[model samples]
Target: MPLRVLSTLDAAKTQYYHFKAIIVAGMGIFTDAYDLFCIPPITRMLGHIYYKSNNSRIQPAAEAAMLVVALLGTVIGQLVFGWLGDHVGRRRVYGFSLMLMIAGSIGCGFSMGTTQARVLASLGFFRFLLGLGIGGDYPLSATIMSEFANKKKRGAFIAAVFSMQGIGILASSIVTMVVCRIFGRKDHSTNDADIAWRLILMLGVVPTALTYYWRMMMPETARYTALVELNVLQAARDMGRVLDVPLSQIAEVDLVPPSPPSYPLFSRKFFFLHGRDLLACSALWFLIDIVFYSSNLCQSHIFDIKDDGSAFDAAFKVAQFQAKVACYFTIPGYFAAVFLIDRVGRLRIQVVGFVLMAGLYFFCTYLYIKDSRGVPFVMYGMAFFFANCGPNTTTFIVPAELFPARFRSTCHGIAGAAGKLGAMIGAAGFFLISKGGDDPNRDEKKTGIEVILITLGGICVAGTAVTMLLTRETMGISLEDNEKEYEGESVQGKCFP
Candidate 1:
């Protein structure tokens, strides 16, 4: 590597070191976690407000109605916003999603009915709109932040942003507990619960507004601007502006056009290439979402009955407690993954994550022994241990690194959509599986998530294998320098970790 280039690259990174990208990215994730985790509380509050005294209706049916509607909306969000993230810039997409969030929260706040059927029917349409915004967030926030961050510390930043999953869960639990403690401490007044829950739903607007601020401050991706023009040099110049360096600073000394485009993702030698790697990324992402969304959304059932005086009320509190605890594990796990990815290398960390998740799944088999309503907390702690620290972090980091500059945003959109597909399947699977069976509450606790975890573990392993074969290393090099290494190439001072 050239001396000035090496030091300048380090300096460019250092200049932005304390600049607050971490906080912005973390908050983005916090909003996501808050949006999704509040479901259990919302359901409990809804039932208490509108249907508890009826005593003849099933809470499970009410819960299922809300979940399926929200999940379907989320799937739609993923596809629509994901394409927008590629076609539109990430900053702009945040505003569009925020509008959806604001509208949904407003709809949910006003919903009221004296009957279960009225309650479910009203909240269903409201929450579906909310899910659309939540779905839009995954690709837009994750993709933009990944593109803007410095490479050496990129893993940590991305993982840190994702760690908001835990924080959001924790924040929602704290809010739910506070609401319960103040109001429900005396009596289960339907009117009180109704007002309290509606207030919480309205609070979602706080994040929607803040998301606008966070996104507005961020620069449109330098790489993205350059690519749309279809000029590598202009792309470098755009990146140079963001990095606050001159165009002369980052461009290759011997610049010619980027390599000729290859048509297929899978080709001769019968292994991974850019296309195959992207395929693997898309497929695996879709698979993981299947497990993650289902488990997260089904918290009320997974934690099972508390057997306290009010089954629905007590179950909601306990489920929040368990989810809060799961957050504790993931927070530290994210930092650990960030520290290790560049040092140990991306593929190794991802494989280790997959292996760890596989081991966690095995333990779930025993945890789900007959008639024993297991503590799903520890099982998820293990999964989070691997996920935040492993594939969850690396899988997101790798796609931006692996694809050629020419296809980066397009490929990211495709892979992100693929991951969304997995999330949709997992969410839908949980919905359908819960929809089936005479006793969904009992059955989901018994067999629902245990089966899904094993399936996610298997898909993660396959995705990891694709990286090892087709992907080249991306550690400690500039994007331009790394692209050189990808085409049977080498660059001075540019070495893979």
Candidate 2:
């Protein structure tokens, strides 16, 4: 076989454009998390306004739909945009997703009707549109950042981009808390409560709008240019411009392209080559998101709310509590992953994180069994901390690193879509499992929250085992090297060696 040639992108030193790419990509994630998590607080307030007779709470089905609908949109978006990113070019379709997000956010804010059902229908539809945009952002941002970063810092860079999710979550909580404080009245039936949710929804538009021009300004990734399109000169020029190096310097470098894959994405050869990788990436993401989205969107349900409090007061308290947890624990875990991912390696961190989270979950389950609220809450916070620090962050970074450049975004989207499916399951199932019956007010059975915690713990344990069996460490290795490694392994055996 001929030797693989490294392009300017594979060999180029990290530069200003790398960090710039992170910021541009990271901002999109910030908007995604902000928009998604903001709904939980609003849901509480919505219950009060729309269903005043039922203790100011909307039906459990409506609540689940509000969270799951976006995830459904996300799964669809990941598949569609992931394909489009590869079929067209990343930059060509990148800005369109942001525009969708802007439109969706505005639409969600304006959702109104004569009846609660119509209003919720409008809101769920708009949020689904918003989720489509957010889903598109996942593969695009991960692919863009991974392609831009040097191998030495690639894991950290991707992790940093995802870590913005922590910031987004924190921002959502903070915004909700502040909005509630300003607009919340003792009587949730008033117009002020209605305005607050709208304002919070609209707030997502600001960061997304700010990032649009910059996203448009970014050139197509050099890997996509040279390898996928076979436009070596253009790739070099774009790389030079982005790296702020002279075009002559890039031109002087040896930019031999690697041999293209011999089979199509769905062919038997392709499956043999990458099936294990796809499964590992998809399964891990699926498990992590089951807990991640469930915990995030169901915060009000998990925490103890005082029966004596008014609806507005309960909503404000929940928002405040969530903000504190995110700010203090969740956000910190993301940065911890950012700091350690490159140094410690992806698999190790993921394994350790899963193990830690499993332990925490089991402990929290025990606490729940004992009917102990305060300690379990702290343990839950700790679980979130380790999750972001470990698998939640690593699952995203690993898939972007593992795939071939041509199919990278598509594969990442598949994995991400799997995660969203899990999110949908978790979002819907959490309500069913936690409530222990169809009746929302049913007393907790032995199989209630305790069972949910135990299941999550089991998922973490299984995730840890799968990581050991299927995932390879990609730290300090160029994307090209990683691809070559897999290609070599495929040639040696029918499955990944």
Report the number of the highest-TM-score candidate.
2
TM-score per candidate, chains pooled: 0.79, 0.93
lDDT of 1: 0.61
Local accuracy of candidate 2 as per-residue lDDT tens digits, 13-114: 777888889899999999999988887778778877787787776678888999999899999989888888887989998998888889999999999899
Error in Å for residue 430 of model 2:
0.7
List runs of model 2 lying over 4 Å from the truth. 1-13, 185-189, 252-261, 307-311, 436-446, 482-497
- What are the clashing pairs of model 2? 47-56
Mark the regions of model 1 whose C-alpha exceeds 4 Å error after superposition.
1-11, 16-19, 51-62, 112-119, 230-273, 307-312, 370-380, 404-406, 431-473, 481-497
Residue 409 miss distance in model 1 (angstroms)? 3.6
TM-score of 1: 0.79
Q: Write down the worst ten-residue block by lDDT for model 2.
A: 488-497
